[model samples]
Target: MRMPQGKPGRRAAVPPWLRARHPDPVQDDPRICPDQTRGQLGLFPTPPRQFARTHAARISDRTVPGFEAVREELRKMADERQIRARTIWLWRLEGIARLALAARDPDREQVAPQALKDLLYSGPILGQALHRAGLLAPTASHRLVPPRGTGPTRQGGQRDLDLRGQCAHCLAWANDRRVLCAACTSWGYHIRKHGGGEAECNRCRRTLMVSDGMCRMCRIIVAETEVDTARIAMDYGDQLWFARPHAAGLAVGPRTSGTAAARGRFAHKRRLARARAADELQPSEHVLNPAQLELFPAPTRDWSRLNTATPPALTTAAADLVADFFAYMRGRGWNINFFRGSIRTLRILTGHLGADAPIRECDIRALVSTGIHVQGARLINYLRLRGLLEAQPPRDLSVARARRSASTISSPAFAAAVHTFIDVLLGQGSTPSRPRSSKTIENYVATVLDTIETWIAQGLGDPREVTKKHIEDALKPLHGDQARRLHTALRSLFRALKRERLVFRDPARSISLPSNRPVPAGLPSDRVAGLLDRIDDPRERLMVAFVAIYALLPGQLVQLQRTDFDRSKGRLRLRRAGRMDHIVYLDEFTLRLAAAWELHRHHRWPDSSNPHLFVNRNTAVDETGPPISTAAVTLLFQRVGLPAGRLRIDRIVDEAHHSADPLRLIELFGLSTASATGYVLSAHPDRKPGPIAP
Candidate 1:
């Protein structure tokens, strides 16, 4: 192919093949110069040369002699480079021009020539440029001299002081020289300022300025809140002494406050004045007005003080017996009230027997001869129980029967049958395949034994002689459910007897009872509110809320532990027998109440090892301090004149009516399908039944 030759001043020819690929190559290609060819491809292009010349001319026009020298040097370097000479020269020129423009005075039109030259060749500036372009060796120290005409360097120590002036702890900004910001300073200041130097109100523990030792708010609260000061003083005279009115006003004082200390000093003075009156007191003067004595009992003389001085005229054996009686009462968990009553009884016995009498001479018969025989009988019983007296007290048949009521059976065969049946139900006897709850077995056995005993008391002595007529007579007075329960127990008993070949016929086999009953509608809302309000204790209120709002059964509530409540999720999970576990979502109010009750429970029973959600405060009777029994809960509701069971039924009925979904009710309350269906029907009796889908 033929090549096209260049025009007069144009440098070279382009090969025809190159021209053919791009016809009129200069006009077609933006990057290719008309005078440039592949032979000069590595050399500087004309466009970059023209750009450098224009920039150098502008720098020269500014009369920056240092910049002009830099531009000339850049040109020399460009000529030395074989490749990208013009581009390299342009970049170095641009870098020197930028430094000159930056170093120029803001008020002046031109930069200092010497300063511009110094900055252009400075190690820091050149090293920075190389570092920015990623051409400097990373391992090599890139530290360079500071450029001339730069402002003063920041003081390291001043910067550290500024940083420290800001909160050293929280690192928040501070206006003044402080280690901590205003907020942090205030927090610590308040803590130390109010720690404990000032006197605090006894009721609320708020700081008090008045030496009376109560803040204004607590004083107002005490004024508004009614308290029987007279009754409190009468009952606890030593602990609750009233102060005289001061010039300011009448202020109710707590025994734990400063007023109490003042009152104690005044009381000491009064006691000194009363010493003469006490010395003049005759035997007859000791007799108190019966009416006044009922409100504030006459103080008993401290016999221990007299005994310590004169060893009490009573024999050593008698003193030992008295001491042992008190020890036994204490070991049995008797309260101080019992000790007080026992002390009074002992005083009467000692006065009657004459304090000098021997313990062996003080027989129960002789004590009974004094006409106050009940005290004598109690003392004799205690002596016998403690093995101090050998002769056992006569056993009253009525008391014996009452004590043995739970175990008593009319016939030995019936008793044996009942035991065997319980063992079978508990998976311990001959027919032990069908295991049952021990509690359920106990209930069934009690009912069966009671029914059998009643029949025997009515003249049917033998199980074989008892007929269906006797069973009907015994169950006649009971309600429908009660009758059904009795019948079921009797039927199971007779079946077990027949299995054991002890009886041939089942008296309760023919007795049929209704299988379903309408669910009871709960107490009215106003009544429920009143009952809940009547329960002031947080623990009791929370328990009632569980039954009334969550529809928890007594057994479920009693079994609930702290682990059952999911605080994060605000849900209570319960495991029930014969149904899927239930999860109840708690509302904010209920959750708050639960939390408050939990805190109160911990405070009241701090030493308790019980994990129950609700626990009784009394740990003497129950060593483990378990949850309050269902009977105790029932009694609580009874005291408030509300039925706990009815409240639970009300909650269930309310939920059933509101949702009308049997499956939802079953899931929510752990109710059986049949029970849920019954509750739904009872809630909305007028609703038509839907067709069953098969």
Candidate 2:
């Protein structure tokens, strides 16, 4: 019954009972060293020096310099878990040994935690065992806690591997009963796969990780190739649907670029698809109808709404009012999509308010203010538009403050004078024939403000302190149109001040503005040609054409409505603010572009109540919305790398070159006498007027 003990530095002898139990222990288990022995009961084996020396020797030859401690840690893990010696040897050779050799830190005694986890990811049982035995750090184990009813040594663990139920594809929380999140499911397949951490991408010729010789971007492109190619094919089927009338008679030039042509046709198809799917003209199930209320399905659970402690119910009267509002919207030609969104928001709002309470604007604002119902703005709009809520909401004071803060003038007297000057420009007595436009008033105010701010900075406080020298000094730095504008603004400001007795003299009156106009220069012909060729958007193409070909200003462009075009006569009657209407006879190119844009507009918004020729998604929903803003039109021109003003000037100057008659320019473009004469002088320098006879 005694344990076997070997001589110092020598092997232990096998006991008689152990030898009888297994006469060929080494042959039966290769992991059993020949010099080791078991106890009399054949349970725990006796410690032997040869066993440690042999194991250490095997690991020392294979592992890095300082990671010999890993072998001892592995032995401890195997012993604590009662793992079979053969299994321990297999784990060492297969997993742990590889990790030790792969250690990036050569001088550290233990392999890095991340290295261990990465090596043991596929085998959770071994990872947990090593973690329990203290060989692997807690964080080093791939699975720190085994699933219920599973042991550290047992296999086939059925634990959910995802982190917080997140999807493997999108990294977003997966919905119940699905592999991918809702957004990922809706977007279809777009997963990017990266392979081994080394290799060059075949497509982009960049050094990056690749799967099947394709980088992530290249793989994405490949996955989307089918969809893109199909869309392109669809575009090609309808090439001449908006072709110019005279295109057949003209000598053919190079075909439109593939990118440009595909863009235009695809845009048309997309608009058509939207119109078909809008369901505005289709018979819709009006769930808001009182008769259908009994059959309507309950809305699905919204987590945001569930955050409320006690959600209220919709009152009978309030529900009826909301139903009436929906009906009013329907009568006004709003699409079902607007109805669907409004209903969801209204439902949230009604639940936030009590069952007995009527819906009120102040109450809705309170709910939004307290963050209880953030989606109540659209609901408010619906109620207000239906006339059930007539009173308008209070304006945002913060916006008013921000606007006021833009005027940073310091001197009180000078600021008052500037304010008075603005009032005079907007006075009731101003004639309608020469009324100042908002832009012109803004420019006048801006010029006066700048001059006053400069005077204040120079320690002059009163408008009376400004002199002829000050006016001349201000006009010194500015030249061309800027100088003329400054001179005009100063003269007007001083005249108003002198008339009001706020100043003694009008210093700017004697200083005459230079009348020389700068010669107009056109953008490069090649650049213009390239821009026109690349213009793929129907609306933008038309906008640019109006500026480049017909010389329409941005102000005139935004004023155009659907009524301006004369379809039968092929003419566009451009109505000016204060001048006679200038008629443009549409050529084959402009006509086709106009037709395409009209078709696009019709299909994109079949139920749109907007009357403007250019309507976007925002304006299309409202019945009485204004045309596209001046900023939006300017942005359109900017995107095409051409200024609208430059285009207009170039077109005007080009027209003048064809005919030097000022009257012709005036009649054709509705230009004033001075503007027409300036263009004529610029185009035909030989026709310059002789010196005036005294």
Per-prediction RMSD in angstroms? 37.4, 25.3
Question: 1-694 in candidate 2: lDDT tens per residue?
Answer: 3444664565567778878987541212323222222111111111112122234333333434324444455566667767667574655444445333333332233333445443433335444444544545434223322222322222575544333344333333333333544544443333232224546655545554455665444444443332342333332221121133432442312222222224554566555655554433322122233333345534322343354433344556556765875776676556757456456556555555422333456655544554433545556655655554424456544333322432567877887776666556655223322446656666677666677788889989889888889888988998888888888888888877676667888887888865865787666777677666777888888888888888888988888878888777988888866667888777888888899998988777776767778877667655446577789999988888778998899889988989989998887787889999989998888888689934
TM-score of 1: 0.41
For residue 413, model 2's alpha carbon misses the true position, in angstroms, by: 2.1
Tens digits of per-residue lDDT for model 1 on 1-694? 3434664555466667877887531212223112222222121111111122233333332333244444554455456654465886466655545444433333333333233334434434433443343333344132112122222225662333224333433333332434444554554466457663346545444443322455433443343222322222322112121232221343444433223223444456445545544454322222222234245522324332232211223334455666776786566555646445444445444433333332221444443344432244345545545544435344444333322443578576556666666656656666546677655666676666677777667776567888888878888888877887888888877777777667888777888766766555756778776666676888788878888778887778778878899988999989766656789998887898898888886665554556777776443233333566678777877887767778878888989889999998877777888888888888988774768834
Q: In model 2, which range of ten residues has the least summed lDDT?
A: 39-48
* TM-score for candidate 2, residues paired by index: 0.49
Give lDDT: candidate 1, residue 47: 15
RMSD of 1: 37.4
**Per-prediction TM-score:** 0.41, 0.49
Highest lDDT scorer: 2
